[model samples]
Target: MSFINYSSREINCKIVYYGPGLCGKTTNLQYIYNKTSSEAKGKMISLATETERTLFFDFLPLSMGDIHGFKTRFHLYTVPGQVFYDASRKLILKGVDGVVFVADSQIERMEANLESLDNLRENLEEHGFDLDKLPYVVQYNKQDLPNAAPIEELKNLLNPTNVPDYPAIATTGEGVFQTLKAVAKLVLLELKKKR
Candidate 1:
């Protein structure tokens, strides 16, 4: 659930980026952190192993703008993508207001994408968040790689519900903001409904 601080007049939303190992979850956060102005973004903190794989999660706090007098601050996170980190993944989903499933675009990683996506749904369910009702988006990342799956096939497998989806190359910043903006918009709309 999102937290609204009446005193601070801030609406803090948590958005988690989830996907299989090496699917570019951290890359997406890093790209945004690098591109955003220092004033707009806070320092990105990553709990990762020495090899740089996310150990627990990656967090970046961003402030966009005021909405009806409340400052909208987004806390973006990326769960550890490795399969064995299920516990960590569940913990990170605890207060998610939105989700961006960063599916690997390579054809060989299709099964991993499916498994990770299913894990996402199951974890969210355990936390009382239904994937179908959540503010969700899908990002087909690493689209620049050779043997990337066709958009249609990817959509069929990962986004059957046809949520706002984007084809992205996170390393190049391609389509990153589009995906973020879409999910953030949905989250804000959900907040409006709650109000």
Candidate 2:
């Protein structure tokens, strides 16, 4: 559901970052916002609760490049990771062009990661979008932590479909852009296919 603004000759695509609570989805967005040049990005708006958990979603409009004559703009969003925020999550996913699932790599959060992934599938199904058909990628965040699960184990548990995945440390910005770029590339390819 990419939006083509004829007046501005810009194509706006939505890419949602989703994961369990405290899985570093917001951190990924923040890092991208901080590192992106001001001219290439629009203002980033983030809504969070007192504990710094995302209450809604973080919105960052970024200009990736141009397709034909239209400027390609990706509006990156991260759904609130809390379980109670399921309704908000569904709403934010309505017209998503791509998804980045940021899974917490710590051994203790494995269950949470699985639950969130299942929730993501269910929510996408409700919106008439199959996760299998969507442009999706996985990011194993917090890989720098000593307690992080092994990459093989994480892949076995989280990426059974073998979609593009990356190991990341969101705080220090490792693999953040790589994950973003991979998903964004998929999204752009999808767009090209549709055209």
Tell me the RMSD of model 2 versus the true structure: 0.9
Give the clashing pairs for model 1.
none
Task: Evaluate model 1: give its TM-score.
Answer: 0.98
Scored by lDDT, model 2 comes in at 0.96
Which candidate gets the maximum lDDT versus the true structure? 1
List the pairs of residues colliding in candidate 2. Answer: none
TM-score of 2: 0.97
Q: How many pairs in model 1 have backbone atoms within 3 A of each other, for residues 3 or more apart or on separate chains, i.e. clashes?
A: 0
Please give the range of 10 consecutive residues that has the lowest summed lDDT in model 2: 48-57
| lDDT on C-alpha atoms for all candidate structures | 0.96, 0.96
C-alpha RMSD values across all candidates: 0.7, 0.9
